[model samples]
Target: MEREKVIEVRDLVKKFGAFTANDHLSFDVYRGEIFGFLGANGAGKTTAIRILCGLSRPTSGRVMVAGIDASRRPEEIKKRIGYMSQRFSLYEDLTVRENIELYGGIYGMRMKELIHRREAMLQRLSFTSYGDTLIRSLPLGLRQKLSFATAVFHDPEIVFLDEPTSGVDPVTRRQFWEMIYETASQGITVFVTTHYMDEAEYCDRITIMNEGKIVALDTPSVLRQQYGTATVEELFVKITRPQRTMV
Candidate 1:
């Protein structure tokens, strides 16, 4: 059986005045796969993700997210997708449980359902003991986990995580990826953007962006083979290097 495509983008373009943030980008994210969006800072990864999340409009091209045209029915698409931004978008003053409740309420989850999910999530993260701790007081790793859990509190079909593991220690980053795997195992499609080349290897497939254009798209192993490099970092350097000639 063939896998279903959860996200479809065709010649997607996004421009801000004279600047093009996403230039004719196109890609597909299959259901139940971890799709990594890799790029350096200012490579347009965030711009592209924003367009797909229906948070911003594209200048041209077509985008269908979760079977709905993003430009035409963004609200419908919003209901089916969860987004965790790079900034750890949680209220610092609020307790972990309160933050979860806030996001659940926004998703329109019933009170009883929210309570059940809240318990499960806290248990899964071993955060039940700190349920009442203010988000600002928690360590960075715990705060990141809480942000991720809050984003998917209502169990959306697709989740977009933008640089979710930035600033985390290596051990914590590994733990975070394990949680991502757990989420994928539950049949949720994960669309993530990160600057960590090693993490790209964990993705089922990855798309690398350079100067607002997609320069490489393939599985990590295939990308390594194609670039004749041992790692994604080496591959990325090769792919992004500009041609030079002796004068």
Candidate 2:
């Protein structure tokens, strides 16, 4: 069977006054795949992400997430998708369980179901002992994992993660990618952005951007071969950085 398109973007653009953050961007994210979005700071990745997640409006273009119109049906789209921002969003004062319950409430989960899920999640995450621990008390890595678990607890069709592994240790970053892979295997589309070129290689396919336009899109292996580079890092430098030419 053919893979399903969970996110569709065509001629997408986002502008702030005279600045165009996303200039005629276009791409599609398929179901059950990890789609990496990469760009330097202020390269329009965040603007486009906000538009796709329904947090911001697009200046012009067709955008859809999980089959709902992103422009006309943002609320509906929100209900069907999960989001984890670069800034961890859980309440710092709330305990591990309380944070889960709070998000569960936001997702409109029933009390009984939430209770059941709470225990299951804690056990699955090996967080049972930290049920009463405040989010501020948890390690950054643990907090990152818990944030992801809460985002997907409501069984969203897709999950948007913006720079999920920034500031994390190498081991923790690997663990986090394992979770992303597991989520994809379960048929959930994963859309993520990061600065680490190594992490970019973890994505099944990636879209590299510069100045609000997609510079390249392909699997890591293909990109490397097409660019005749040894690594995604080299490929990124090749695309986004200026090259010195003989005069």
Across residues 45-72, which tens digit of lDDT does each residue of candidate 1 receive? 9999999999998899999999999889
> Where in model 2 is the C-alpha error above 4 Å?
244-247
Q: TM per model?
A: 0.97, 0.97
Instruction: At residue 210, give the lDDT of candidate 2.
Output: 97
Candidate 1 Cα outliers beyond 4 Å, as residue runs: 242-247
Residues 1-247 of candidate 2 have per-residue lDDT tens digits of 8778999999998889999999999899998899999999989888888898899989899998999998998999999899999898999999998988988999999999999999998998788999999999999999999999888989899999999999999999999999999999999889999999999999999999999999999999999999888999988988888574111
Judge candidate 2 at residue 191 and give its lDDT: 93
How many pairs of residues collide in model 2?
0
Cα RMSD to the true fold for all candidates: 1.8, 1.4
Q: Single out the weakest 10-residue window by summed lDDT for candidate 2.
A: 238-247
